[model samples]
Target: MSYPNPNPYGPPPGQQPGYGYPQQQPPSPYGAYPGGGMMPGAPAPYPTVMPGGVKAARVMLFVLAGLNLIGLIFAVMGLGSVSKASKNASEYTTSDAMTAMNVGKGLLIAVIVVIVLFIGAAIMLGAQFGNGGSGVRVGTIIFGVANTLVSLLSFPFGLVHTVLGILIIVFVSKDDGTAWFNRPRY
Candidate 1:
């Protein structure tokens, strides 16, 4: 009877069925080969320690800053209510003390900034006047007067801002540890 070829091509007489043939391996585009050449079962690297949380403290700080800002806005809006609300005996009717303080302090800061601007401008104008610039004398005088009036009007607001800034510094300073400083929101 006919039999299948022992090899696809001719084979030597003493050669057994699949003797000396190389074993087939799975394909790999990467240079990795399965054998002892590379360590096959090694684990990937991992971080030893997790990062610390400081988000809470930062949020509190930002909130305090925003309160200060809101206070300034109120002072600028020409609301006489800040003082009136502050003086009210009933807690419900009166403005929150912290809110009032922030607004007042912000007002104070605005006044101080305006005063600094005034002083700088005054010095510049004085120098120009000294240098024989007579043309700007009237304009300088007008600026000085306007600045004084504006600063005077903003005094109450500045006082409020100062108080709030002090409060914020005090609270933030008291919270010393990273956990305290980084208090979580909510």
Candidate 2:
């Protein structure tokens, strides 16, 4: 079932070097061949090869981070919507209306605050990974979260603001030839 190498580059004695064949290495402490700590016939730890490609993993992380940011923005906007709905129901300022409006406003404000904090975190991470310290990632997150929340609760114009923030983060993050923090362009 096995054939001879017929050459030095070919398979070794009693073993082939191709598919399903085992590779040979030097021996050392801890074991016979040091590969598995067993005898000279032990096998190597399956190869410490990387699971997924680095580039692909990095890209996926960047994307998930971005999507999470967007989700945070949407959550904040939901708060404002609750507020507006409450306000509308209180046009006559009745006791029930007033209570509803207050609850809505409180929920809306709280959500907005939480969204702002999340956006801030994203901006910090983005800046750390992307452009230098001068990056407007933080500012963009703030403006985007705020504008989107307000727009959702008040008007439709806030969409533009949210989009702008996303654009800034994505574009700046993609820029190359810049320092890690705010150092030189190296």
lDDT of 2 by residue, 73-139 (tens): 7766776676667657735668877776687667757766755665555445444544334454344
TM-score of each candidate? 0.29, 0.32
The prediction achieving the highest TM-score against the true structure is 2
Q: Candidate 1, residues 1-186: lDDT per residue as tens digits?
A: 656767666565566756776556664434365552433554323212211222232233344345434544654544455455455547554456657656875675665465455445544543443232223334443553454355345477445434433433343234232223233334
lDDT of 2: 0.50
Report residue 87 deviation for candidate 1 (angstroms).
Answer: 21
Runs in model 1 deviating more than 4 A are 1-95, 147-186
Give the Cα error of residue 131 in candidate 2, in Å: 10
RMSD of each: 24.2, 14.4
State residue 132's C-alpha deviation in candidate 2, in Å. 11
Q: Any idea what lDDT model 1 has?
A: 0.43
